[model samples]
Target chain A: MTYLLLFLAFLRVGFFSFGGGLAALPLIEREIVDTYRWLSKPEFLELLALSQLTPGPIAINAATFTGFKVGGMLGAFVATGAFCLPSVLLTLLVVTFLSRFRENPYVAGFLRGLRPALLALLLRVALSVIQDGIHDWFGLLLSITGGALLFFGKIEEIPLLLLGGILGLLWYGWR
Target chain B: MPERHRHTFLLFLTFLKIGAFTWGGGYAMIPLIRRELVEKQKVLSEDAFLEALSIAQSLPGALAVNTASLVGLMIGGVTLQLAFVLATALPSFFSIVVLAFFFLRFRELPLIQAFFRGALAVVVSVIVLAVWQIGRKAAEDSVDLVLTVVLLGFLLVTGIHPLFVVLLGGGLGLFLRR
Candidate 1:
């Protein structure tokens, strides 16, 4: 029953999410926390963190996590399938038309407008991470330095993630 | 194998590799796809890759998934399209499940807690990086600059539903696109 419900819920997310995973932030939040009542606000934040740290698209990562929490492995598979199935079908149907109208002015305008909002929405998600991830003073410092490295140095991402995990091990393990 | 089977297998392998290895997600896949497919194998022409990327981004799904579908559309047909999309989605699906399994099971363990905490803190920084990169690209002009400020301010202050924000932005964009 919940499997079907999970599928139905993420189906909306799969279709409507524009821009990318971050673009889906508000929608995913509303679906999981506000509408379905599957996860609490705090639980959702943890999911977001996990989504960020894990590989893959952030939306898929979050959906899988939430589904696992709700209904275990089958739930994970169902939620992911439901979430992506619509977009796959929709893409097949629309690619022909989309290519034809790729540069339509209205579409361009629509994308232009969505851009800043997507960035702003990402900012909102970023804040949620700070809220929870900053467990102590050292954690804040680690976040600051990590931000510095990413923005200033432009280090490739895989290493940066590894560094963060290693830093965590050192910071928390010894202390 | 038949020509059709060969194309499908190629699409699957390529998209599977992209999905499994590409980090930073979405836009990050753009360069990798260009390098791996466009430059190396010549599976897709540069123009086709760009066209597909634009179409993918303009549509609703994740860029990586959408791009793979578009690529599949070009290389084979509907059947191969499904194959590509699934291949792209598969890696993330399995990995997160394993991570979630452990995360849920041993969340109470102090050692694991410490590691996740550190990793998550860095994840926060990654979010900020995403914000900067995306914002820098989008907010290229004064109007966009104003839109960024207005939108970011509204999101931070009013806490309006983002659906309304996206809709309002699109509605306003129709007139304001300059």
Candidate 2:
């Protein structure tokens, strides 16, 4: 029953979590943390940390972590599997339908129309994540520095991540 | 292996590689997929890839996984598409599981905590970059700019579920473009 609930929980994440993993957070928070109580908010934040460090999509990683905590190894596998299952099926369906109706107004309209709204949705995600992470003055300054370096400075990503980890170690570890 | 089997195998391998290397998420994976599938593999041209990307971006789910599903369907059929999805999901699936196993056990170590705190900050910056890139392109002209602001206000104020926000956007899209 737990596994079934886990599958269904992640199924909703797969079906409706547009944009990406960050965008999926609010919904996942609502479903798993609030509704099911599978994990506490603090535990969820830890999973968020894990999701970021681990490669691949954030949503999938979170699912695996929660699944493991709730139902053990099998729960982890089932939750991760169930998370992606819907999207895979839906992707195929949409691709097939779109190809055959490439010129259809509705399809074209949907694409043309979704732009502004999607932008806002993504913005909401960006703002939310930034709001969550930047707590102290140093954290705020770090994010500003990170954002500036990434966008304006044109620094490469790997080194930036390394520098960030070092800064965090020096900052948090020392304090 | 049969020719079909070989193609499917190669497709799976290609996605496996993409899934393994990508750090930021679906949007970050887009360029990598473009390089391999469009530039090298020549399974899809740049234009077709972009078009599929457009559709994939709007749809719910991970864009990388969705894009793979689209590409796999075009190259082969349902079976090939599903194979690609599984291949794509597998690397992240297994890697996260392994990492979580270790992370949970050793999380209390000061070094681990420091590293995560730092790594996570950078990770968020990567996300900010992704959002900025899209916002630049998406927020063209006054209509788009206004819609973005209005919707931002609406979501933040109303506290509506994002699922509904997205669906409402779909409807708004039809009207805005008209």
Candidate 3:
């Protein structure tokens, strides 16, 4: 039953996760955190941090870790397998009839429209994260500094994550 | 060794290297895809690579995984396609399992909690940046801009399922075509 739920939850994540990357985050959060209550919000954020810090795709990392935490090794494999299943099937379908979808305007139009909705979804998720993570003056300051470093200074994300950890240790650990 | 065996072995090794090495995931693997698949292996022509990329982008699921699957299919067949997916995902799978084991174990420590608080703040910043990046591309014109605003508001107000949002976006897009 647990394995089935893991598969179903991640399968939904895989199917609706168009444009990939961070765009898929909102849906993953919905299914895992909201629907199943598998991982709490803070835990989800921590998962996000780990996913960013680690190698490989964020979706795959999320699936593997969530499954492992929720079930076990087999659960991890099952969830990851479920997540990849849609992409395999869909890609095969697309490859087999490559010519038909090559210049399909309907597909293009749908994708174009998808971008805005995806942006909205991402924004909603961001807002919630801000609400959850930024609870005090230091939290606010950290986010601002992190934002500036990421956008203006053009530093990479992994370094920023590390820097944040060290700063947190100093700021919160001591106090 | 037989030619087919050699081809399969090369395919497996190339994808494994890609999955294991690339950091930051998703589109981060594109350069390696170009380097190994196109430049070194000479399996896919530049045009074919781009085609696979576009298709991967269009379809749902992880861009990295989709691209790997397409490339695998192009080179071999369904068997290679499945093999490539496993090869691409295995490294991350094993690493994350190990990491999760540790993370969950030490999650209650105050020091670790402090570290996560800070790290999560950065994670929030990353998501905001993602929103900004996608926003620029998504809101291409007045109609798209309105669609974004309206859909954002709708999501905020109703808290409807994201699947519906995607379907609604695609449907509206078909009719709202300029």
Better candidate by DockQ, 1 or 3: 3
DockQ of each: 0.60, 0.57, 0.78
User: Which TM-score value belongs to model 1?
Assistant: 0.89
State the weakest 10-residue window (summed lDDT) of model 1 chain B. Answer: B21-30
Best by DockQ: 3
The C-alpha stretches of model 1 lying farther than 4 A from their native spots are A40-49, A173-175, B156-158
Q: Name the regions of candidate 3 deviating beyond 4 angstroms.
A: none
lDDT of 3 by residue, A1-175 (tens): 9999999988988999998857678888898899889899988889989998888999999999999999989989999999999999999998887645846788777877787788788888889999998777888898998998899867888999999888888899997
Candidate 2 chain B: 10-residue stretch with minimal lDDT:
B169-178
Among the numbered candidates, top lDDT falls to: 3
User: What overall lDDT goes with each candidate model?
Assistant: 0.77, 0.75, 0.87
Per-residue lDDT over B1-178 for candidate 1, one digit per residue giving the tens place of the 0 to 100 score: 9986886787678777877876565566668777877898887899988888877887776777788778778767788788977887788888888988887888767776677677777777877777777778877788877876788789779877667777777777888883
Per-residue lDDT tens digits of candidate 2, residues B1-178? Answer: 9997897798789888988888745556778888988899898888888777876776677777788877777778888888877877787888877877787788889987776677566656776887788788877788888878888899889877666766776677666564
lDDT of 3: 0.87
Candidate 1 C-alpha error for residue A34, in Å? 3.9
Worst 10 residues of 1 chain A by lDDT: A94-103
Clashes (N, CA, C under 3 Å) per candidate: 0, 1, 0
Would you list the clashing residue pairs of candidate 2?
Answer: A113-B173
